[model samples]
Target: MLGAVFVGINAWLPLDPLKFCISHTDCKLVILDAERAEKLEPIVDELYAEQKVIGMLVVNAQEGKGQWRRMEIFDKALQNSAAGSPPLEEESVLAEDEALIMFTSGTTGLPKGVLSTQRQFLTNVLNTQVGPRRAILRRGEDLTPPPAGPQKGALIAVPLFHVTGLTSYSMLATMAGMKIVMMRKWIPAEAVKLIRSENVTLAGGVPAMVSDLLDSSLVGHPLEGLFFGGSPASELLASQAQVAFPTARLSQAYGLTETNSVAVGIAGEDYMMRPGSTGLACPVNDMVIVADDGRVASHGEIGEIYLRGPNVMKGYYRDPDATSQVMTTDGWLKTGDVGTMDEEGFLFVKDRIKDIIIRGGENIPSLLVENALYEDARVREAAAVGVPDRRLGELVAAVVSLKAQYGGKVTESSLIESVRKSLPPFAVPVMILIQEKPFELTPSGKIIKSQLRKLAREHWELRQKNIPKSARANL
Candidate 1:
């Protein structure tokens, strides 16, 4: 195996975050498309001067687009450099060597780079690859190989930079000899067509995307395996999916970037039986629900979830303090979600204690949005919370109490327009509620997000009250 660590950067990142990561990771070479290169044109010289990125290989470049210094066309570079080069001497690849780095948002506004070792990466692949296959076999499906004609396909509607997209979809599909079909963007009608045309065997997306796909008239039973993640799927949606795709094995997985992709999963009939639960822990992993008093919770008791496994991350890249904060002295990672482990070991994710809003499976840090709002002089205090929506699992929305002097002068639309310039389109607040009162606070004077979340969800529900119940169900 090559001994190079690959940093997965979101292709949709704006210039500020893109530059921050390029410099933070001490990246040397970057491979991007011509359009992305054009986006970096203004800071090309600055990046080079700071030695953040010394070289670039432009993928999908036009004939005259490789004019940037130290930049080469991807195809030409591959052809000229590796045409006749001799194979290098083999080196031993250690299991503990760093393999992949992915950025994840936490309580802090900025993203932290979560590092995974080779062993951890491979373990995650095995965890995902084996779970569904065994589920299929346990259900009495024939294991005999079909005659070699067309390869089975995995339809990927998510971004490749994500842990689920890269590890679960791309790597697992490649290892299983399945054809990978990636969509540039998610369009339910197009996704349905691709499933039919490509002989897709496995396909899935977040609950919100799946909701949209199920509502679309174009959807039909396609894949043998159907999985959902990003956020918990409601009982109604899971029931809807099972009814629509009777032939497919419906699955739901639970984990974060720190766990590679999945730590617990449920599929098939078991998934439907307990649609509210995220399922049993992986056989090779250790999971326990720790109570508020620092002891293991009894069956059906809610507590903080803790996970330990070969697939767990090594640490946050170059940030031991942050890593230590999340990990116990015994090595178990403290997943801030409160959940209960039933007698059967199925995990019910009752609540997420973290202030991270997952919109369509993408983690949006509330602190990040709050920081952007604070930049405007009119914003006295702003709390960004997840607003429930039928289409997106949660949409980023803010409640702002302006400074006394600027209270009546500021408008919600103006504040949203100001943040759009800095944050990515998806990260921008979709709804900004102008409030006159301060947010509810805890005994320690910290903003009570649980209270704010309730308010946000209620606001969303109230706004949709006028729509017909049948129409609102799929909105």
Candidate 2:
């Protein structure tokens, strides 16, 4: 029900984080599901006293019940709504008018609300359309008639709160008149069923969701395209996806909340050609890799990626200080992702600059170790981090989950040896911990490396305690 026409300025906030944003933004109205109404009732007084909210609109409410009994029920309000109102007329909206306020994932700190203007949103929608348009052009000289019946549907498995689902997929779908099969919550098995039942032609999300779908027993579904964004995906995973969904065009996009959505996309044959790259900059955007010295990095040199385009957000809502930190005076938004661009302009994301592991004054890219571990046939997932070490200042450590078939067969020492073969001595992980469970992921499908680092440190400390004094001294 979070459609483009009805909601002029859409802001999605989870219940737990709702108060902070509402209070900060001085939100005057709230519309929510009736089931969640009770949770907010207790805080309504506090919110009202602070002038954060003035009224509530409950959806899916019983005919008559609860504190919101007098409030306007959203479903009832919509029934015969157009007939009751005067003829709808399009209102003039400026390009600079705020259209959305999306909050960052806050993986490293507090979530910052990003303000996006109508221009940014519309520009992103047009830029994304170029991908499919290019695909159709590449189809080449076909006289075949368009498929009969309704437009093809796309399965939306990601949360609408994230830019990938909302700006990139949902908005684009709306503009193209594509039917959307939205999932209230992501369930791999249910997703497969929807793909077949609804005849979904396009399906995309984080790599984790795609991995789950490929691993599931669903096959021969009518999925024609699969694209993912919001995180880095290994080449190994992309290659595996090609085999699993042979008929589908696989793509990997790169973008962030500050950029509205996708600023770069690679799909179909181009994706196959550049296996690990995040593709070229979108038609409407300009991308540059800047080194630490504030100079533009040459092709093949890793540096912080910067993007400049109309698709870039206006600024952080009510946080000019935070906005100034990330956005350069020249208008480029620093993406904080360390990456390189080949001569062909294909971008390769190495890892986040903050994610690099420093071991004894030597900087080691955690992605390198993770990619090395992924090369092993037995490893299903891997994360590398630096744990405090008395002698080395910080030591490289890895946590991995093996493929079910190789669960007991694969050992921690063996995985470390595998990485050693592919990396330098200093880059090789000193400790390797096998996870019995999967790694925690953000809504965007990125692994929570902070949690993994904490787990690795705990495991290492426990191992040190278990070692004999003589053995510890030798180590």
lDDT of 2 by residue, 94-186 (tens): 788777787663333245688888899778887776555555556673534467776788888776767788888897778767789999877
What lDDT does model 1 reach?
Answer: 0.82
Worst window of 10 by summed lDDT in candidate 2? 1-10
Task: Give residue 29's lDDT in candidate 1 (0 to 100).
Answer: 86
Give me the candidate number with maximum lDDT: 1
Off by over 4 Å in 1: 63-66, 83-91, 142-147, 467-475
The worst-scoring run of ten residues by lDDT in candidate 1 lies at 466-475
- Reference-based lDDT, residue 401, model 2: 79
List, residue by residue over 1-475, the lDDT tens digit for candidate 1.
4577899888888888887777788778888888778888788888889867878889888744656655788899888778877766676779998898898887887778889999988887777855576677878987676678788998888987888888877887887789999998998889888888899978888887778768776356655778897778888999988787777889888988999988898888788889998888898789999999999999999999999999999999889999999988888999989999999888999988888888888888898899899998888777899888777778998877777787567777899998888788888987777766566677998887676667666666766786322111110
What TM-score does each of the candidates earn? 0.93, 0.71
Q: Go through the candidates in order and give the clash count of each.
A: 0, 0
Model 1 TM-score, all chains together: 0.93
C-alpha displacement of 460 in model 2, angstroms?
A: 9.7
